[model samples]
Target: MGFELPDRSVLPRHPVIVGDEPRQSGSGAMFCHLYPANGQPTGEVAGAGAADVDAAVAAARAAQPAWRAMNGDARRDLLLRYAAVLKQHAQELAALETLGNGSPVMMAGYAPMVAAQRFEYYAGWADKLRGQTLSAWNNPAHNYVDYEPYGVVGAVIPWNGPVFAAAMLLAPVLAAGNCVVIKAPELAPYSVMRMGELFLEAGFPPGVVNMLAGGPEVGAAIVGHADVDKVAFIGSGGTARKVLQSAAENLTPCCLELGGKSAVIVFEDADLAQAGQMGLSGAISVSGQGCVNGTRVLVQRSIYDQYLAVMQQIAGHIPVGDPLDPGTVMGPVISEASVQRILGIVGKAREEGARVLTGGQRLDGEYADGFYLPLTIIADVDPASSLSRHEVFGPVLAVTPFDSEEEAIALANGTDYGLGAYIHTRDLRRAHSVANQMQAGMIHVNASGEGMQPFAPFGGMKQSGFGRLGGEQGLLEFLQTRNVWMNLKAPQ
Candidate 1:
């Protein structure tokens, strides 16, 4: 039933599953979703309301002791086996993601694949969990610390990259010996359920990993649940603020992975071709839905026109069609609301005196139901406009010309966000200086975006979000430190 790509406008005649047991409900039973590939309604996902959250939490609370008692090696084995299961069902999982979210099929598949890799990466860290030692000057004794896990981790994921973000939280939370109750996003629940199936196959104790699916109520319930020790959330800054407020009641430690309006800077001495390619790819990947996307381009005034010409030519050709189509490089913007939001930003940019270089039209031809926005490029956009300072989350790249290194750095750091900033310069001193000046979690030197790697840390400094998600820091976020003091002095 899932293999066939239904038309975007019509609802599919199926239902997405809820639990490990093939307990199914009719379409729209739980979630209000359409096929992401075509922007049509698919089968309804069964919703797990308040009662479901309680049940899942109870299950997790009950199983926590035993699951926590298990050694890290055993957990590692289970995760490795789970990784294998994901690999085996990758095709099925990928198709589900593509259908549930409107991203290109290839792009949708990326989350599941990366999620599996993430699990494997954290699985290796299970046994490597460690603490530290601190010196106590006041007393003649050895002082140290131990890393420990909080009991039940509540994971609230966003629709943009449901599987990956969930895995990003879950992998480390589990590896740190914490049981988790994951609440899938209302907009994209299918992929989360698919992940649950993989976990079940990985042989995690039944209650150790539970999934609750529904809307805001369900997520709120999970985060506020008394038994849940920590909350890991990935969503908008507005939503994240509410989550933080909600979590405050219980003093639950919360990690918020929020939004961004990242910058990509181009200097005259750099490789223009590489800069253009990375700039276009960074802004357009995931249709500009990613939190770390390079939506703002700061080019040196000398080469601004040349860079625009190259960028315009390349942006014009980005494939926008059926996400399932192998040739498609860009897809719909996830929802109609997102499309409207992007359009509003474009209008605001024009009012602020930005020039539309190319692609400012809403595409309705070929795929009528799909919500595809043109690969838009706005030149000479005011740095003060929302398009330059806020996240549009669409295929729109705003370019602003800058003169000298100080202005480039000043403009890049002007926004409230500090997620990611990119710089391209052949001069080593200039690149290093620019990289240091930008106030962001990650700064890409001579590259438009940070290439995917398992080792590097990826997170923002300011409003982009608190806490790291990848690399050693990511794993550490899920872990807590405990000091252990040892005394060699003879008992007197």
Candidate 2:
């Protein structure tokens, strides 16, 4: 079976891009405008090239000294102000996010809330940024390490969760005192542009945070720009590879959060009803666009049919409509290309002999204009099938059976991606062992989803990309430690 798409009118609304902004996407509505690469906006997108990047970098360099000079309290206060401003504009922000990225308005609302919490979390950390104290190995002396921010960070965000991911990268980077030049993904640049207004209102100096809307050339230029100290990106592994190659030109440090095809495990002893709901929720949440979504479900063979029946029922009930509709549960994908990519994955699944239980066809006529693919459930997926291994980035779920705990572990850990994994079992000891054995950055026991927490580290262990994004560990991602040593006693 394959995925089905809804009719055109089910499409999400798009926000208008403010004047002179360079925009893309077949649907138009001006989602983004290209800014000057050097820090000035050329009337034409082409003219806003290298010189614009240079200008932006120069502006950032000039502003960074003063920005960094602010005491921790001042920085924290500014972030607190920013948080308040974001809260005040939550509705507007949520609407913009939905319109720009085709996410459900409800999920879009979560962005502002999460962003606010992230700000609050990092705000509290600003004044507490500390290094280490240690004894000198070879001398009667004490040594300490001081943490400092790297100047001029280049942030390259993706379209899936534009506002939320940008806020995630921005909060800690800024709170740590680094000036930023963001290259917002072309697909959803409007959301980022709107955010700049909030940052300015919150009193961040101009050039301290700059934004640009363009494609790979722009990202390459920003990454290789001589003045940039580091680069942060969230996107596909293919693009991540290119970004890394580009960043290497200047030896700039990079933080990457790439793609994943996470798995969910269901043992016979587990709760089938709840796990079924969780499986559907894990697969369809964000329309299956999240990196950590459990797209692959490994059910114990004894209950595979029962579990599949429940999942199919739940997936069939998911509402596919306008993202603006308060009652809508799932929305259109960000672009037509995304739809094509998703359908292409389905085609491959069929060729590879997977059984599509429901939603394997497109809903034509009315939904022709909307880029939406129906939630798809595939059963009897061959262990070696591409559908079980790759990220479809759509509302597609693959179910395969496992005969034993070891088999379940093998199936879940087979993917190159190590973002997250899910396990459900009544036996606590078995759950613990499985959790420890699963080859993923995060694991959910008896649960089918993962979420961000301020005190826990989040990142993958394999091809899913590197570095933590939350907790004290995540804060350190944006900081550089400097070691200082002195002899408290007489020098030997």
Candidate 3:
């Protein structure tokens, strides 16, 4: 069967959403979207420009006071209702995600509910953010700290997982009583644009949430806006530098979530079957475009060959085809450029003496037009090679062998990016020791498929970018602290 796409009628026509209404871009610029499944024209939407970004920011600024002034219980109730609305339209949003981004329908289906869960999780936190009452050293004085919202937040999300990224930032931002302007990725803006509409339907104030669908210029404008109190960005580190440069002009605080070259370490005593399956899945899930994917695999030398055999068998059997097909386990990357880039990295790895155990080439025949690459495993990868050091952001796994537990830990911490690390081991003490030594923000032991939990902190370390995006830390990202002191002995 051929690839199937979602109905265009379900997509929003006007991508610039302000004050609870979807409207045309002020600049009248339009951008077309292509279906990654077949590289066919999906449709076009008006692209936001500097003017539209300014309008959205202005709207958010105007709405922030009222949003913040509302009682926390009221804000919590609205967020809870919004979560329900997201669940109600989960399938519709999932179809839009698969249509534009080429994630398999089965996997894409989880994003909406994941978003809903985030909202629900943060909803409980809405009324629960508390401040500290400090003991004063001076005579008869009361000292306390207050958490205040940043007033306005500008968020820039990438194309790979728009809905999830939107929820990741938006849930905590909104619950903390901040108004926001979200710059949806031009490559895949459908689901996020619809998300803006859902916010209004959930009875949020008119200007509380605004979304702009555009390219880099719009993102730049949002980051540089002096009125924007805070900025949250999720994308490549290169782009993050540009964002930082622009944000510096206004001295706006920023929270960035960038790319990773996460590592998966497997000890000899590990359940090789489980390690191979989950380790490969961690590297290739989301078509290997995830920022936190464990694409670099470090195995103990004794079981290195045995692990490669298991990985090769599993990778070869993984289904890679039309994203809409329920049976398809892997789908196309974001675009043709992504396919070329991933293939180029694989080609360079081979030149550096990395052996392609399975699936190093792009698929042909039925998937010729689409940007498809099967799950690739390259064994004998040199730890010092570019393949092991840089982020491929594709479904390609680079495996290197380590002689000891300490060697495995060194290899896992060898990269500049420290977003996530995975270790598969039978020994609990080793798991704890290695996990403590891993430089990444999040670590998984004997498991890789649990995914992001809403209750814990999610972020990276070092070059992977700073700032937490889940749990209480995420909520605090949009808030500022204020210290207050009052004299209790005034009457004396």
Candidate 4:
């Protein structure tokens, strides 16, 4: 059965939220958000420009001192209230997400609840931000370190998972006593724009949590704003480099959560069924739009054929249709451009000698108007090809075979990305050894499920960008350290 889309009246009109109120963009520029399901205009939002960004940053700057001055307990209480507000409106937010982004409604529905959980988790850490005491060498003196917020933070989130990303960034930033100016992706701004309203409803001070919806110029202004103090970005690596360049203008430190082409290694003795299921799920979740998805699957030569069979069988059955349908397991890519880009990448991989096992074409019939592509499996992928090196950011799995364990390790770490890695094996010793050798921020041994958690640090090394966005470490990203030294002996 098909699911119905929500009425357009539910969409937000004013996409810029600042100083506790939803306001129209200062530039009066506007853009229409397209539903990925059928490429139809979902709704229109005022596109924020430099003037809006300046106003938002000014608001954040003005609000930071009082926000920082408030005791941790008070901040925690407000954050808890905000989390409850998110939970209360989760259904509305989920519907907006499905309309704006193309994630299955059933799946999009979970993002707000998870976001609330993240807020609750970070709320517990509000009062626990502590410093360290140190001894002065051979002197009658005391020394200690204190952690303090950077004051105002500028955050830019991607479209793939807007609500969750906003929560992931805001929870820790606020918990660390920093006010934030966030630039929500223009492609999917409805849910996050609503989140800004919830902050006011939850009793947060005006301008403490400003939200803007716009394109690259808006992000650049935020990163380059001297008063922003610090920046946290989640997006593609190409965009991250641009953000870095802009941030360098003000010498602002940034926490970049960028893209990845993560690897999953399956050994001979691993449970083939589980490995196939988990590996495919990792590659295809969020319709393969995730930054840390395990899209590269490296298998031992012994079980390589068997693994391919399992993966193909699984891919063939994954339901692909309208995201609003509760029965649909997969939805369209974010836009027609995305569908074309993914197809171009797959076509190039074929030219580079990778064999398409199944689903290398855009879906026709009822799905033709939509940005839809079935789960694609490309076997015999060359490690040196662009398909192996660059991120496709779509539901395309590139499978390669290796001989020795060393070869598997080398293949897994072959790409510039080091965000996440997975190893499936029965041998405990082998799992540990392989996991230790994998050059990624997070490693999963013999298991793969939902991607990131609020309790653990999640980031990447090398070209995948740096800094973290989860757990206590994530809170520290928004804070700076101050050292104090006091003389114990008074001069006579």
RMSD of each: 3.1, 6.2, 1.1, 1.2
Runs in model 1 lying further than 4 Å from the true structure: 1-29, 136-140
Please state the error at residue 183 of candidate 4 in Å: 0.7
lDDT, candidate 3, 458-490, per-residue tens: 899999899999988989888999999988877
- For residues 52-81, could you state the per-residue lDDT of candidate 1 as single tens digits? 777777777877788778888988988888
lDDT of model number 4: 0.89
Candidate 4 C-alpha lDDT tens digits along 1-492:
343557877776667887876886546468888888888887677788888888888898899999999999999999899999999999999988888789998799999999999999999999888999998987789899999899989999999999999999999999999999998888888888888878888999998999888888888889999888998999999999998998999899999999888899999999999999998975568889998888999999999999999999988888888898888889989999999999999999988889999899999888888888989999999999998888998999999999999999998888899999999999999999998898899888876745578999999988889999998899999999999999898788
Q: What TM-scores do the predictions have?
A: 0.93, 0.89, 0.98, 0.98
Candidate 3 clashing pairs, residues 3+ apart or interchain: none
Better of 1 and 2 by lDDT: 1
The TM-score-based order of candidates, best leading, equals 3, 4, 1, 2
Give model 3's TM-score versus the native structure. Answer: 0.98
**Candidate 2, lDDT over the whole model:** 0.76
List the candidate numbers ranked by lDDT, top first. Answer: 3, 4, 1, 2
After TM-score superposition, the amount by which residue 409's alpha carbon in candidate 3 deviates from its true location, in angstroms, is: 1.3
Clash number for every model? 16, 23, 0, 0
lDDT of 2 at 377: 91
Pairs with steric clashes in candidate 4 = none
Q: Give the per-residue lDDT of model 2 (tens digit) for 91-118.
A: 8778767766677777788888778888
Q: What local lDDT score does residue 206 receive in model 2, on the 0 to 100 scale?
A: 69
- Candidate 1 or 4, higher TM-score? 4
- Local lDDT at 424 for model 3: 92
